[model samples]
Target: MAATRIWSIKGRLDSVINYVTNPEKTDGGKYTDTELQALADVIDYAEDEAKTHNKVYVSGINLSPNIARDQMVMTKLQFGKTDKILAYHGYQSFLPGEVTPDQAHEIGVELARRLWGDRFQILVTTHLDKEHLHNHFCLNSVSFVDGKKFRGGSKAYWQMRAESDKICAEYGLSVIKNPGKGKNYAEWKAEHENRPTVRNQIKDELDEIIKCSYTYEQFWKILKQRGYAVKRDVKYVVLKPAFSQRYIRLKSLGKNYSEEAIRQRIIAARNGIRDLDKPKSDYNAWLNKYEPTKLHGFKALYFHYLYLFGKIRKKETPQRVSFYMRDELIKFERYQKQFRFLYDNEIETVEQLTIFKENVENKIDEMIIRRSKLYDKTDSKTEIKTINAELRELRKNLRTCNNIFIDAERIREHTEYVARLEKEANEPQKQQIKDYVIG
Candidate 1:
């Protein structure tokens, strides 16, 4: 199956252009030396799935791929549509082992042609750096034909999906029969990381309110009093929490949170029947179910960080997360990478991480000197290429090590901040205890 996503690029158009065509970084995330070497060892990378040794194939529709960025910029300038969005970057990713790199590129080119080939300028690149073959399209927001901006929204995405499905069907490829609604990157990332969002918070609130509500009307009243604006519809009930700008449909929450489900839950509560559908509320139950492993070094720090950020024990009932803590969710992915780097290298402490980084740097410097000498040779091309590849991996590792130091320090600071907040929150209870003891 081919999955697709498109997002707008606001700043520099060349950044995205250089990324897709450039060989250094294909997919996001820092790669280990092993992966880099594996990519480098493949000396005969095909140019297309069709006929060349170029592992990646890049094509420009209505423009040259070489200067696609400049052309896109010139079009934007001609139309005076350069103020907001510069370009649109979209990707069509195929399932691994399903399609060859050439076939994937052909499909990508066809899809782009059917969608935007006539009106807008597009740069289609098929990147084979990863196991799954995917195509990246850098589309100019401003159309070259009419100088009109490509109106991008849900409609555009659906249209792209429909065309992609049609093309994939023609190619005898599997398509998503029932694709879920596309969420923005931030929301999707937050959900993936198990960080609490407005939707989750609202679900948690409903879980609590449903227990005490004996009637459907009582439920709506309780929800409104709890700062949720209720909009009853013939088919679906929608709710807007005080903190959320958009109204969320009840059905969107889950099958359990649907209007009929809510009414059934109320009836069950009225009959003194405990809800089997209720959230797993007992922390002890979670502890008994899964034995906690003792973590140390960066791994332990990451666990603690996730815990304090309200992402550690997600199986239990959701808690009302502080608005301030939501911002830290973005760092969860970075911290995960740092943890993996430390664990994979077997570096336990900050000092160990420092030493490891130094070792990588020393190796890099030595390789650079060797590479320089090999460059002077007329017959050392193979050895020089291998050395250059190894050097790039070393430099990438060095950069990752530097980032680990900064991230480790941030984790420490956040840990200390959480401790202070807990202490402040307990001050009143401590004062009450002292008064009782004195009395």
Candidate 2:
């Protein structure tokens, strides 16, 4: 069982972090040297996990552990130097039905007052429904009850852990063993935390279910029953199983059985891959011979880059509000590029789209001039050039974003369009291109 042990003492916020991490201190907290040392050791043990010689690494530092690991930041503002340290020593201990830590602490502290005459102001509360059961206790070094300072957690620390464990046993909760000391904190962390990732841990469970099916047909049915998707082809099969909303491809289930091989087997066992394949015989043969689906997906990457502005935030702590704005702009860019590409690609086939697009740009220019004519006198030439360039550049990107079968013939067509455009970018056509490049 794991735990969440949190403890701290306080003074100046800067001083506390400096002393704990970089240990040495600078100013006044009104506490004497003896009081300071006692508090420092408690912090030392809590932070070092009680090991002067051992190093341990624990994580779940929200916003990154480096910033969130030390919890005192929030509390320091509540109470500062000259104010008595008021910390809530809490933990998610692996004990069930045990008395709350505060109750236990209250009983112990109260008894100490009766026996040793050490009185202090103490506050304790338990929090449930979390990863573990724990409590928070706020007590001053000196008794607010009787104004007496009490020594805490040095030699008396192990006594607390042991006492808590013994108390748990009496209440039918399991007693936890302290693996540290007997084994220092750092060494214990090294011993644990070597566990596997969730994905790897599920591998065995997946194999157990999947291994039962011998052939692709059997596997396909079982997979479908379990909500997995099967894609069929003449060569092999593709199985996509989703786990926790993320999909995984069981590309190679067995040795010598590639996804394509399985897909084809599964399809042949049922019908064939022809149903999903494109018609047009020669092109079909070309795809089967040279352009596989794997080859086609790479062309999609080119399309992905067409509208990319490459705007990066690049900040230490990114202002989260801007992420969605950036994403929306990217999506709008994609929409514009795709619309233009379809409009241009249809120029020869539909002819109407080309005329419609020209009219739309003409209207946009008319509207801009009519609206801004008041500010004119200036050669709005620069502004006109800028907007036209924006239009042309957007169109150019659309041509690049096409995700289609890169059949050698289709590939040749794109190659020619690119070559002609590149050649046209020279001297004579440069002015026409520049007309559109102004933006």
Candidate 3:
């Protein structure tokens, strides 16, 4: 089966181009120097890198694969439409082990051709590094022919889905016949992994409150006292938690936590009966399972930051993280990439990382000169393609090295923050140790 998704890119067009064209799903790091300044506009390196496929699977419509970035940027400049939304990025993913890489690329090319080939330039790349082979499309927001912007609305998505289904049917690939409303990636992953979700959190809190409540009125009153806004007179008992933006209906939390169910649960509670079916979880078990070990250098730094974010579990006092960093905590996967890149490269000291980046940059320059010489000397397409492929790989490496530097700076800053947090969290323990020693 093939599923399609699309979104707008409001940032620099080059970043999206660079990401989609990344030769392999490799590279991670931070900002440094003027190069680092450009890295600031990169939306999510982890997500982009994960979706990057083999260069052989990459194709461009009305543009060259090697110079797709320049052509897209030039088109935007020609139309005088470089502000706000820069491009529209869409993807078509197929079920795992269902189709060959060449077939996937062909399907992607056909999709882009039939959809926007007449009006716009598109770069279609089939990424094979992931479990499911997927195609990534980078479309210039401005049309090359008429200077018109592509509108990506509900109708656009419907058309995309319809076209993709038609193409999939032609290829004899499975298509989602009655696709229902889909959840966002995060929500889907959370549900799949049985992770804590806002809905589950609400249900858990309600369960606790129900045990203490004897009547429906008392139950809502207690919920309000706990900073939850409730609209009890509504068709559905809608509740808005202080930390959440949208109101959640009581019926949505499943039949067990429905308004009538909650009332019955409260009645049972008053009659000396408890809902023992509500599964209890020991949150501290995660901490207990983690073995404390000493780590030095970049690995140690990344480990502690992840630990502070509640990603890593260890038996230790809870450290205070800045309220602003709560969002960052949800992005531990990105942090993990940063850590893995450093680990894989054996990047220990700042000096080592700087030297590595410089080496890659120097190599890229040498490869560029070599490629230029080959283009001038040889009329052979094969030779030119081979050199271009080599150049793409080297360029991807250079991008990763640059990101490593950029992320290293941020990592060091968080390292200091983590140190301060640890010191604060450890102050009581240290005081107790000192008192016992004196006694």
Q: What tens-digit string does per-residue lDDT give for candidate 2 at 174-217?
A: 44546533322322333353221223222332443444555656
- Candidate that beats the other on TM-score, 1 or 2, i.e. the better one: 1
Ranking by lDDT: 1, 3, 2
Off by over 4 Å in 3: 1-182, 195-250, 269-272, 275-292, 304-329, 347-439
Which pairs in model 3 have colliding backbones? 29-403, 29-404, 29-407, 30-403, 30-406, 30-407, 31-406
Per-residue lDDT over 1-439 for candidate 1, one digit per residue giving the tens place of the 0 to 100 score: 7899888989888899888766543423344655544433222222212233434366677786666778988988897788888889999999899877656776887789889988999988778777888899999999999899888888889888878877776554666544465244345546775655566667766877898897999999988887778888556677887777677778888889988888998898889988466464332332233222756777677666655544423432122334334445545555655666766787768888889988987786677566656644569868965875675467558767888778778778877776676677677889999999999
lDDT of 3 by residue, 1-439 (tens): 7899889999888888878756553112322344433322221111112233312455677777667889988998998988888899998999998766656776787789899998999988777678888889999899999899999978778888889877776554666543442223345455576554556557656877898898989998888987799887988778987656678777877889887788888999999987456454443343343333645576667766666655322223342443224335444555666666666677767787778777866765665556545533436546755754565455555656666677767877866776777678788999999999999
The C-alpha stretches of model 2 lying farther than 4 A from their native spots are 1-6, 11-81, 84-88, 95-118, 178-439
Reference-based lDDT, residue 346, model 2: 42
How does residue 176 of candidate 2 score in lDDT?
A: 56
Better of 1 and 2 by lDDT: 1
Q: How many backbone clashes does candidate 3 have?
A: 7
99 Cα displacement, candidate 1 (Å): 24
Q: For residue 174, give model 3's deviation from the true position in Å.
A: 25
RMSD of each: 14.8, 26.0, 14.6
**What is the lDDT for 173 in model 2?**
40
